[model samples]
Target: MLEHELVFALREIALLGGILGDVELSSSELGGILGISQQTASRRILELEEAGYIQRKPGVKKQLIHVTESGSERIKAEKEKYERIFEMGSRMRFSGTVISGMGEGRYYISQPGYTLHFRSALGFEPYPGTFNMQLNGAELNKLNILRNREGYTIPEFSTGDRTFGSVRFFRAEISGEPCGVVLPLRGHHKGVLEVIAGENMRQKLNLRDGDEARLTVFLDR
Candidate 1:
């Protein structure tokens, strides 16, 4: 797969074509599977062919299409990506300086809408407050990628007159102790990371403002 999800999708289509004995496929069939219009499907196929990721069998009455070696390499690249992700899950690392938050985490986390999902998904009751950290330049970039990563999602729901937005959680270890990273679908700051655990992290970890802390985030939980 390429860096973009759309490109990966094209590669996946080609791989499927290769699997069915390089059989001919109609635009309608491809469009149906992709939930796209037949015209769009035809355009995608043309683009894939131009990129050398797929080819139409010459002189074939049925218009057979197959994945090229280049396309197979793209799938191989996707495999390598997952491999790296798993490897990172085992021991992925990130670090930042402990910082201060708006002091609202305690209120939001204490609510049932957030707490129930936290316990169900992360397997622990988060402490009343969240430990805030400021990521360095490189770590901030990593956090951006981690934001869209697969994890547990706490859906948005209404409580009383207000509705709360959904949030995502990833199992992690802060300074080698089990914890989690919480990210709201809408966030206030880009460089900040908020952590949750069963205990007050600042006290348990003996952390203070300006102290540098590292966390090992597990992608698969």
Candidate 2:
């Protein structure tokens, strides 16, 4: 049979953690079934395992393989991830961080009137001050941006209201980096939630919404 490369590759790497007994698949065995070389199959297994989509366990005779909760997450996330890449391919819009000569590493994000600045980097550090630095792309590529797979859902303290499908990032104006993303409330909410980041962010990184803070979201299930 023609292999279902993507799905099979995913499953081959991570076994379905069944409700009953433990079952594990070795790369050599799965490789033969999928018509891929053992090394290729083994690499794939490692990749999936590293990505947190699957896990391996030891049994008396064989290793146990199973899909983790994160596996479902990857299945859902791949769609959004591909969509973002496709959008970038179609129209080259990107989000980059800008830096100012300030001693501290601060970035800004904003909506129409308000802005906010929180010192962070999901990890990477920003220069003292710069404008719109590109994300992890080639030097020739002017746009720097990162796409996160999972979005957050946070409930408001005052009301039972929840903000669904969230993404966070910083933007700077010193080098023309656009500010963070803007998205509306999803599903249960009657109307869209308009987020206004505070003004302190505006002064630090230099941000404006329509000009830089453009983003989209998928409603919560």
Candidate 3:
């Protein structure tokens, strides 16, 4: 992998944001941020334009540099690469507020307030307005901390449980009160589920396809 590609891509985009508005950059400012000489910065800008990462508006007096869609895609791809490296390990970082929980089930808010339901810890309150956030733990641990170590736990996993129409345990934030917590989802169809309860008892809370649900997983024993 190109170790410096991501870093360079970010720096290039940062420079483009400011330049997009203005006609051009003072050699000193660009060089200062890049820690290179003015000549070097100018050369790199030309190279970026040639590579299609940016556009140069032809003008007699001054040249204007702007970030292109390709540049934005490069930045996005780099971020995904870095994120995947961190996610596959036990070093998952959680950033969101715990909204609500009951009996040790916690739900976190990461998307807008409209979107809830996540794999989180248990134990929290109905934190409605603030951006209550907690980080520092493996992905699962970060979620569980919201339950505040309440009676939230997982049993062993089984092949039969992996099938449909069954009750199973998963760690997810249903409410923000307890940020990282466990909530149960009823498996009715494959990869589709219903929250254990709806507005009325004895009914299943069906979820939409592509909806996000956090699964609390345990080892098969």
lDDT of 3 by residue, 72-188 (tens): 666667678688555533323243322222322112221222122222322232233222122223444544432233333443233432422212333332321123322333222
Displacement of the residue 190 alpha carbon in candidate 1, Å: 2.6
Global Cα lDDT for candidate 2: 0.41
* Root mean square deviation (Cα) for candidate 1: 13.4
| Rank order (by TM-score, best first) | 1, 2, 3
- CA lDDT scores, all candidates in order: 0.78, 0.41, 0.39
Residue ranges of candidate 2 with Cα displaced over 4 Å: 1-8, 11-24, 33-35, 43-51, 58-63, 85-93, 101-221
Candidate 1, 66-96: lDDT as tens digits = 7778877877777776786668745466789
Off by over 4 Å in 1: 1-86, 89-91
Number of clashes found in candidate 3: 37
Candidate 3 Cα lDDT to native: 0.39
Best by TM-score: 1
Q: For model 1, which pairs clash?
A: 1-74
In terms of TM-score, how similar is model 1 to the real structure? 0.59
Clashes of 1: 1
